[model samples]
Target: MLRETWAEIDPGCIADNLRAIRGMLPAGVKLMAVVKANGYGHGDLEAAEAARQAGADYLGVAFLEEALRLRAGGVELPILILTPIRPDQVELALARDLTLTVTGADWFRELRKRHASFAGRKLRVHVKADTGLGRIGFRTMAEWDALVPWLASPDIDVDGFYTHFATAGQVDTAYLERQARRFAKLMERSKASGIAIRHYHCAGSAAALRFPGLALDMVRIGAAMYGFHPARPAPPVELKPALSLHSTLMQVKRVRRGEYIGYDNAYRPDADEWIGTVPLGYADGWSQRMQGAAALVRGQRAQVVGKISMDQLMLRLPGPFTPGDRVTLIGRQGGERISFAELAAHIDGPAQAITTALTERVAKMYANAKEVRCPWNNAYFQQLRRVSDGSRAD
Candidate 1:
């Protein structure tokens, strides 16, 4: 961590959040920890390990590369690629025992054309039904019917069927109910087909916590696992945020009244005031839109007073602050706290956007490495003998 600005991630908080969510779910229902986008920029491997420690049933990633990375890190929990993978990449996925998300029949046809048959293991897959999100997945019964035969192949296993809701986090329940009804109809169709789907899930973090009945077979917990509740009024479970950002004042100076600061004269001091520079800017995920947002300097709010530059931004300090003083960008300092929700409200986006936008240039420091360990004991792994065989399966 050469840079003074870094994100501090608490894996124990993530594990605790997962445990709380699990307690809310039904006994038979599973929890799919969504660790995509580098665990929403909290570090993919670390988040996955935290989920495993909390007894997560499955892991979800958005791409094949992400699943491969988790496998390389010795994550044995069943992994489902939330997005569809290329037909040519099927073998690579199969070799790693990765479950894929199938949207339509054409993907299977192309895969079959590439390889006459899968050689060793049954290709595990989850059928994606686009109830309302409209991002991907089969929308009509006809599309599902077309994709069923391909999924029924002996070499393939229909491990799960799932959908995503567009308005799960919104106050309005009308659209969410409509989408749930549509998904229910699709599930009936699937039942009639007798494809033997193992898991039927439609609820993400918000929907699962808001409506426990919607937790059909599994809930994909992403934002909630990171202590983000997208819904209003909050859910019953207690979730603590796992990540916080901090930096130090790189430079401090006094500016005269009416003197412009930063590029294009974005700001001018009303009087002789102290200005502090932080070594984080738009390039580190602090965009220009955050110009007027506040950062905590010595437990006091300091308004960002100038156009955020590529690598640094100036703040109107509450008073004179020395260089190397600690600045809280998204965390607690004394009695003042700058939360991700507060920052997201400024940007008018989901809390995760602020986290995922953090570029690799901003270093990440894990706070609790010892507490979040593998839940499985040595005897458990020894009995499975997977460790000796280098097989990632439980």
Candidate 2:
């Protein structure tokens, strides 16, 4: 890439992470690789291909546009849109063979008004139960009751029923247990209605990794598939980070003790010090929130000394460095490393926020692309082979 700054994505690492997570799951349970937010900014198509090569059964995205992008990229896997698409977009989603997340009956009512039928095609859907997340989903029984009739329509297929846990990553499991119980009850109610829901799932990456019991028919793997996990009660399986950020020292100079640097005089050297300017800044997703964070230079930590600018940021170097010296913004350099968790902790946010915040201006250089290969002997792939062979039997 022309830009000196870039994110290195290892598709092999993503594949390995999925394989490890798959090993932790129960037999026959499916894995849905969540590639939302452009695979948490690691590149959606790359991540999906990696997941598919690792034998992922499904793919998940946050928006219709994202699903459409995947379809355009030649991804033939079943895709589920985690968020509700607009009623008007139902036909578009159907045309792409996309599964949708249905939260309430109102959305169905609106869709029916627009298109009385799905044009003889079964609209695959996953009904989302709020459980305890308080985000999206049908919470009350009345809401579920209102939704049942629409789900039972001849033109609709109840492909799945699921919910999200709010505190699955936390140490305390009380809230998570409650949410699980509520989801179980909801599933029981849905089953009592005689509607044949094909799959039942409620666990995302953290929950699925930590509690395999929560992995119902499928587990949605997102953050952990990229080596991000909960801080408390560490994950059982080891996962390698698939993404790393790097840049070069655009300029290096010796600043006098009294000389201020950056806009608004955000920093002043206490002593004559070596400073390096990196060709990346807030505009590239390295926001001002990372002002005091550290970068790796010459195998040592260099503090970000000034207010981050739109196109550049200054670092308090360990010593004098060349203009083109390599800077490790989020990766290992010699003996030093700057991890996504460290940066996320600095900003008091999720590790994913650190990666996903990275703007497109910073080029992505994918690594280990040739190493992504599926093991056909694995149970998951064996089952797929059997199904494929059976399909061609007649």
Candidate 3:
């Protein structure tokens, strides 16, 4: 059997998180699910379907290639490419019918030259205003304001105006308010120039929860859909975690006292102990520092007792552990569940310890999609759904 080290995505959780976000937004304010960073390291396509089923009006990704991938997958959602696009990719963007964040005329001109057919097509566009974030956007209010005429041009469809918040989820509320005020000013300037940008989004997952009513036309949600909170507290809503990391014990051996484990002599058996080696480690997204950390062994805590090698880790059980036992690295063990935030905090950072370090070698399995036999195949999702629905017995 293939090693059990993989990220498990629960599609049902995606639907639930979107429902929570939609309930918080004002009625008619749109919801755009941001599926960037491969859906924050949880397979993007699976998360995208979950978000869509949960009532997302639009989908956002960070790059043109990502948007293209979604389209190639037969996903027909209206996707907004949040990154500023180069002229070369504009044709692909047009061919794929993607909404791109426009920064200046040179880039737009390049698009116009290649996709002359765009003159007839309604190219939905969002202007990226650099309202103090100083990232990819129009640098000045005047520069942004001047785009109104082009935005209104019959050739292009100016659908939205948005700004990113540098402090929305990480800093003081007072600072966030200031950034919001700047965004408001930018909107007013756009209005004065007669550019009726229909959608105005300025909130990410962090801002959406922290600044509740600030959902202008729509809110962009990324991490929240995967069941992670945005640094600040959102309105009270039942949030379900959508991802779980798991593995099975590959071998169980009795270690003599003073025996070193794995590489570099990182961990030694405290006493004569039974150690279960699992096929998981830094190569599979389990953190190297998790040595001396804990994994859930059949709902009880088992301490990781060795250096996390590239493809495996050792866990010391208080008693004898069998080779076939299951281990939970990021899930509930009985009544106790390990949160990623908690896992990250345990190793001196956010539970980003594993998710952030997830390598491409690891496979992602979806419990809600059609199952395929391969490690990345999601065919078993139907079986999982049936079990969840009580249609099939365990």
Each model's TM-score? 0.92, 0.92, 0.88
Give the runs in model 1 whose Cα sits over 4 Å from its true position: 370-394
lDDT of candidate 1?
0.87
- The lDDT of model 2 is 0.87
Worst 10 residues of 1 by lDDT: 385-394
| Model 3, span 1-394: residue lDDT tens | 4455556778898889899878977889889988877777776787788888888889999998888888887778899999987877766777888998998766666776776656467777898877778888886677875666567778788888898887775756777788888888878888888776789989987788767778878999876777776333444576778888766778889999998888888778667988888888776677677777788876778888778888888888867766656677888756667776667666776443356578777666767455642454343433332332112212
C-alpha lDDT of residue 226 in model 2 = 94
Q: What is the C-alpha lDDT of each candidate?
A: 0.87, 0.87, 0.76
Better of 1 and 3 by lDDT: 1
- Candidate 2: residue 95 Cα off by (Å): 0.8
TM-score of 2: 0.92
Once all C-alphas are superposed, what RMSD does model 3 give against the true structure?
A: 4.0
Ranked candidates, highest lDDT first: 2, 1, 3
lDDT (Cα, 0-100) at 166 in candidate 3: 79
lDDT tens per residue, model 2, 256-373: 9999999999899889999999999999999999999999877789999989999999999888877767778898877778887788789988999989989878766666443322
Q: Write the residue-wise lDDT of candidate 1 on 1-394 in tens digits.
A: 1346767789999999999999989889999999999999899999999999999999999999999999999999999999999999988998898999999999988888898777657999999999988799999999999998998898899999999999888888999999999999999999999799999999999999999999999999999999986436588899999988877788889999999999999898889999998899999998998889888877889999889999999999888777767777887877888887788788888889989998987866666453322244434423332221112223
